[model samples]
Target: MPANESTNSPLDTLWRVHAILWMVVAGEGLAVVLALATETSSDRLTYFGRLSVAIQWVMLLTLVAIYALRKPLSRIRPQGVAYVALCLLLINTWVTAGIAWLLMRDVGPMPAGGWQALVLRLTGIVLAVGLLGLAAFQNHWRARQAAVQAKQAQLESLHSRIRPHFLFNTLNTGVALVRRRPEEVERLLLDLADLFRAALAGPRQISLEDELALARRYLEIEALRFGDRLSVRWELPGVMPAVTVPALSIQPLVENAIRHGVEQLPAGGEVEIAVSTTPGTVVVRITNPLPHPGSHSHPGHRVGLNASQVRIEALTDGRGSVQTQVAGGRYIATVRLPVGT
Candidate 1:
């Protein structure tokens, strides 16, 4: 299996939870909506109440079934999803059948096998409709997964493109300072090593502290090149919260500030990086002097920014975002990540 797919495999989610409970809750909500739409006013409450009970029973039995068969299910392959769906179907069928039996047991003068026959018919209809819905859900989820994988691949490609150009520039800067400032060259190489390590760490997330450190290293290397012209100011909290961010997410933004903003001016400029949090969101703002008009094309400018935005959205499941603009002679980039506990 491909590494990304392996890392994100659905099979690994078999015995794990959270996503399944969310699915159950969503299914119950849809059932409530359907009942409200189709059932009459007087019967709506009773139907809704019965459905509520049925959902509870179904969820309870589903959990039991998962507990009993978790070991075997874990070994089930890519077919794990189908097997899980089948398990839920059977559990729902039996639960519905039991409820139906209890309701009809005291009915007047029914034939000996009437309840069984009714249950068979009801179960057949329920299974038919339920399986169709499950199949639709599976298809939709697969399509979404495919799209996420494609986006991740694109972001990785963007990351790979960034490293080469950045390394080349930093190396040239190192060569320039090699004879004049040999000791600084050692620090420069160490910073470069740290920057590339985070870059090639794949598409996983790292802590905010670590990401900030990576960005600091990148700025440090640029500082070596620009010396006093490339100053940086950091506005960080005294107590850094244990939040996570996409690897290399902040560094690329800092690199953009250095390459396009400060480097364009003869006197150069200072870059400001501020980290703050509000309620459940972690906000990072990087500000640098805007480049002169028509000076040069910033290669990979949009590419890197878009990739970083996509990665943030993907990492936070759309709870994070990026915004950039040139305002008041400063190019400002802001990233907001949902704080994770």
Candidate 2:
């Protein structure tokens, strides 16, 4: 299975070294108490050692088998995960009992009835451990899924608000210039169509190239609206990193720059968009001339900025962030994203 597809189940989450170690330790501790109570042997250390070694071997072997089967297991549906887990537990118990039986027989004469009883008890104990572990894991998985669903819903809500606001603004721009620049209207409409098409795309994420194209279209409309007042300066790297970003993320920051900074200035100003990469992160910076004092400002821009910031943070699970500030006569919005995002 693909690495990305492996994270879909709770079973996969439980198959870690630390978790396996915990299970082995807990199971062995319980087994020691049971063995000491049931056996008449005066040498408690020998009895404890036997159970410890058996439990350790069984757990280690089972862990290895689980690791080998993880790819196939991860593809199983949520409902089937428990059944598969129980089946694995049964197999692990039988293998462990066989090994323990062999070692016990070599050590000394072992009664057949005693061995049979020991195997049954071991199977029951291991099955109980498996069931408890599965329950805990399933609960954790449900909670995680709930959180993701909530975040997704919030993002979609915020995204919906942004889409209509942008559409109307673009439509109004087109309407305003329809008669004066009849020829430009065709190109304007095409850009508008492309923007909406991208907005309505299947996934909530899009490649950096697609995102940049969408932002450029928005800027194109703003350029038409502001005429010579809006200038764009791009400092893109030689090659754009193949990274995915939350859709509609960059364009909103660009819109904020045009709305609050460039248009507010008397002679207009430049919106500089720069993209660069570090070892594991991709950074996007948008800077525009700071708004002059007493300049008209829309309060909605602040709300929109906050919303976009929240959406990006949610999509990247807080690995990505947005920061904005006015310093050195520039209103700067910077986004830091992990390359894997």
Candidate 3:
């Protein structure tokens, strides 16, 4: 199975805002618990305030160290990353505890025990907390890996569904042309072969220009079948953006326009494809005239549109979308992709 292109490691969570906030809360909770256990009722409040300062300092410093080395940590296995994080926490805790002892040894009421005993207790607490954090990290990593695997499996299934449907439809079109225009059958087969090559390439990204070229080839094959009945209008930008889209993303929408829109009309209608770009996104729209309500409508499972939508969303981490709506008596299928994807 191919790995996700944009998946982040579990260790990466350390730098997230919410995760950091949670860690701070956990540290404060630990300080409160320790204070209640080791201090008298009258002094527990002061002990908690002091312990929170030391604990929070240790946690924040360890987090900083981990973030600074995040690139190297990412290169290591998850187990190794967890071990390193635990080690950092322990080291920070010991160092912070030592500093607190040196600074405040004579300032206030000690926790029944002397500085050495306090150091021992702090080390024990840190080791226990570190182990618990390690376990949590392992669980999170396993869960994330499982989710990625499930998503990849779904993408593969969608791809499988799309390939057979595309192949059958193209083959039927070839069959229709084979009996009438034998010479054109060769060109149609060539195009079909190219499309199949892309469809079978598995989950991957292709340049926007390459995707458009593939869509154009598919349209060419359909043109041979529709002849004068099928007319296409293309509106494209002068300079295409440097971006990648999932394979076969655009072609399926074109196929839907022809099958559901143009093919239903007696005097086949025009299919308009327009591509435009903004500062951060690229949009493609396919429009075809709808047949009258009483006229014969093509019966379709809408597999292509649904598959395209799913594939785009999966590949783009939900940043891209496929949408369809009816306006001005025309059915439009729109695809939006984020730039720098």
lDDT of each: 0.74, 0.77, 0.84
TM-score per prediction, in order, is 0.75, 0.76, 0.81
Root-mean-square deviation per candidate: 5.1, 4.7, 3.4
Return the candidate ranking by TM-score, descending: 3, 2, 1
Q: Is 2 or 3 the stronger prediction by TM-score?
A: 3
- Rank by lDDT, highest first: 3, 2, 1
Using alpha carbons, what is the TM-score of model 1? 0.75
Q: Clashes in candidate 1: how many?
A: 0
Pull out the clashing pairs in model 3: none
lDDT of 2 at 253: 89
Against the hidden true structure, what lDDT does model 2 obtain?
0.77
Among these predictions, the greatest TM-score belongs to 3
In candidate 2, what are the lDDT values of residues 22-98, reduced to their tens digit? 77778688767767676554477876776787777776676677678877877777757677767776787788888
Model 3 poorest 10 in a row by lDDT: 1-10
